[model samples]
Target: MSTYNNQETQEIPLVKKFPKLKVLPHVNLINSPTPVEKMMRSSEILGGMNIWIKRDDLTNSKYGGNKLRKYEFVFPHIQKKNKKRILTVGGLGTNHGLANVIIANDFGIKTSLFLVDQPLTHHVRENLLCDYYYGADLNYSKDTKGAVYHILKDLVTDWSSYYLCVGASNSVGTIGFINAGLELAEQIKKGDIPEPDKIFIAVGSMGTVLGLFIGLELAGLKTKIMGISVLDENLNSTKKLQKLIRKTMNRLRKIDKSIPDVSKKLFERFSMNRSFFGGEYGRYTYEGLEAIEIARNDGIELDPVYTGKTFSALVDFCRNNPNAKNETILYWHSKSSVDLSSIYNNVNYKDLPKEFHQFFDGTVEIDDKAVHCIRKKKN
Candidate 1:
């Protein structure tokens, strides 16, 4: 039932709006109301809509991303349940796993990462090392089936642990994005930025988009959400997100009965784009790399698997709907913005588990010629 902003405590916008929900436990992992600014150069270059950026990337000082926002609700839930460790699964370089470890450590909880196969890249390698550096118990699961097996086995052996789904998109974790939606409403009311007609964000494990969708509707904003799919259509489809949203709404209603059921507004305000998925998860596409270059014009760094693809879809929309005057577009920058060079500097690749060495060694071919991409600008 407490929320902390760094050293200080305050009521989140969601709690302020529904005082009854203030009893729900939360721990702040971010600096609230992440800055929103107009991407002037990007707007002029892209040429259709007035582009704005919601800097969710700066969610924290160490490592920040969309996951940090989710952790706001997730961390407290783990503690309330009295779980001693978090058992989660994701691709080898899961930002969620790393974020989970970093935040969970603060709460004195252990993390066990059941990592499945993904395209190997320097980014993936660095994350493996950082995961070890940060004290995650790395468990290599060859694929999805193996990851599930490991999770099930761990849950049985370790009675105090629980398996949270990927990206922490469950009902409780999703309250983070609901908070974000209300936060954006406050910013718009204060004239920090214009109310965007549409907001473009990546759809991964489905929480971010669904939570934001409900939040905006609850705040009575006319802004629509376009969730560019970064994962498989099976998981990121409209049907799946709607189901999750309903579950989240049910949970919120339990917290506060006055909260309206916005299920009817789902179609009006939400759209999911599976076109940008790059065929499979973890592999970067040409369109996404190009989007990364375009984003650099606005001084934003985006990874291809998620934010890059999402931004590509956003650009396409602006081009496709040219001449829509008075319409503003907001790009949700969800990747981490903090520089982790110092963390990398202190850790040696050799320190990670032996199974992870292939990612750094020449044995594994870097996916998408990722080494070249990381070293120099993509031509």
Candidate 2:
């Protein structure tokens, strides 16, 4: 395996020795101790070194996924500010928006979602149905994904309440990953798995990657994190991330107020290396479909939008990189198989494409009584 370069090692100092920063209170929304499993078959297929999968999909939440980890760091801030309504942005069929609504409902907080149309599957009706079930207020936009930000900006002007960005692309929200890094460090020390040479994950708004990178530095775990950009990698995305990271570092500095000049280098080390986004945001390639099928056959669930793109990139990276044979790679599994009964009870199955119906073969059916039981636990 490739060793950590001196420059990278020098970037992150000890957490305790670093500046102290006051972090915002965030509610716990995810189940801890997510499994890190070895991917022997996948590794063999790629002809690379040891490969592993971090099963974040198994996170103990009603709608489980990597987004739950981030929500844990955001919800408390929402409550603290006494925000009555939560406003979020994403494409139709957004796992992020779906997750946000569930958490908001559990907390007795009303939510409003702005849905945009993307090139991929626009499951607007399905998402709208779920939002209605969860009691989330909904808004639709025919504008591009980039224009949704302005739409949100206009809505926030009349209402004096806290707005939780979809990815929680702020400093407080990013600290969730710092906490995750600490948890991961403990797992490594406990021999849960060997120190991974590289970690691969999906990046949309860049909150998760930024958090993971900062958390790795804080927890003193030396690992390379590769972010597969699910969004378009352009100046706009880059600028947005730069602003957020800077804001995060500044917030951290304020928490401690005693640390030296570490923010700039820390921000640099946490920089995202986005080399694998296929084309525009939300568009999937044929290779992504193949990767999704592969994981599905392995009894792992992956969505076409994010996880599929990330897995495809991991496969290509392993095959092309000469040093991959000597390194250990970890793929973050970040989607939960959707429960169709809640969504399709009154709809005709004939409306779905043949390929889409295949997803229903082994999915668990939860009736109204079952749904009541599930909702009761959250209450």
- The candidate maximizing lDDT is 1
TM-score of each: 0.93, 0.78
TM value for model 2: 0.78
Question: What lDDT tens digits, residue by residue, belong to model 2 across residues 1-379?
Answer: 1111122211222233342332345454556667888887777777745888888887744777777777765776677677767777777567778788877777667777776655534343455456656766666554546446655675668464466676666677776666666667667889988888888888887778777776777666778887777665563376786687778777776767653323455444443544444555555556666677766646777766688878877877787899898887888787765474556365543344332232234332211111111122243
In candidate 2, residue 278 scores what lDDT? 50
Q: How would you encode candidate 1's per-residue C-alpha lDDT over 94-185 as one tens digit per residue?
A: 99999888888888889999999888877787788788888999999979899999899889998899788999999888889999999999
Number of clashing residue pairs in every model?
A: 0, 5
Error of 2 at 5 (Å): 42
**Candidate 1 global TM-score:** 0.93
Cα-based lDDT for every prediction: 0.84, 0.64
Off by over 4 Å in 1: 1-10, 369-379
Worst 10 residues of 2 by lDDT: 366-375
